[model samples]
Target: MILIGQYDSPFVRRVAIALRLYGFNFQHRPWSTFGDAELIAAYNPLRRVPTLVLDNGETLIESAMILDYLDELAGPEKALIAARGPQRRQCLKSCALATGLADKAVSLLYERVLRKDHPSQIWVERCEAQIGAVLDALEKERAAIASPFWFGTRIGHADVAVACALRFTGEAHAGVFDDVRHPALADHASRCEAMQVFREFVQPLIPPKG
Candidate 1:
């Protein structure tokens, strides 16, 4: 198995963290979507990061799909997500919120960097509001949970997703994630990031291009 993409990407980082936790031995290619678009396109025409090449010459695109396949490979007991019922729904919801927040952060970053001269304040405000809303919702959910992870004692998909998203949000948009404003999420992210798996696959945010 091979994992492609820079760890700076929250999507790619999540997948990489999961692979380590699952004990999969694979190659890591820190390819940038901007600098290595053509190379990535050979495997994923969309040229997206977090593209996983399976052992048997098959390729997987998108972080979610790659994670689904990995969970299947790990089987029911070791799967990161709950196998059924309300547990699965709750986990998915949190993951959705976290990933959505990450998307908005990325979009806002592009707006400022790519359109520096005429960035739309209205659009930027909308993205900031979305980011804040998601953070509030996640912080509330996290605060109500007593477990070290989102799902009881064991870490799960939601934990990884939220942690990765929070890291990216903070790195890409400084001062956006205030520890005082969102203490629960701040603590949650801190714990997850302290893990060896996370530390092993870490990368600094890529500077924005003009």
Candidate 2:
């Protein structure tokens, strides 16, 4: 499998980390969607990062879809998510929240960096407020988890999602996740960073200039 796009994106990075965790053989093509539009367009109409191209010439776009495929490949027991019940829904819900946070961070970034005019200051404030709310919710959510993983005692996709989302959030926004307001989340961030896989995925990105 060939994974396209850069790890600076939480969406892409989560899929990459999951592939590594699953011990799946894949190649990374660090193409930038912004600068390498034609290259990304050749493979994915979405022109999105983390597009997975299978060896058989099949393509998967969007991180969640790619992740579901990966989990299926891993089978029920080894799958990164629970296959049934409310537990599965909760786990997916957590992943969605984290993903939403990452999405907002990216939006905030693009607005600040790529646009000729600044976004509505109210919208910016709303986005930041929502990001903080998500972080706090994640902290409480993580605390409830029985293990280091997001749901249950097993290491699963939720853990990967949260870890990747937080990494992108911190770097993309340049220190907006203040530690004082989110001690548990700060601790959670530490645990994610302590993992070699997470560390391997995180380097540095071009900080969004405001």
- For model 1, residues 22-118, the per-residue Cα lDDT tens digits are 9899999889998999999999999998899998989999999999999999999999998999999999999999999999999999999999999
True-structure lDDT of candidate 2: 0.83
Residues 95-192 of candidate 2 have per-residue lDDT tens digits of: 99999999988888777777637567887888899998999898887766657666656668777788788878888786788778777667777877
- What lDDT does each candidate get? 0.95, 0.83
For model 2 the local lDDT of residue 75 reads 89
The candidate 2 region of ten consecutive residues with least summed lDDT is: 201-210
What's the lDDT of the predicted structure labeled candidate 1? 0.95
**TM-score, candidate number 2:** 0.93
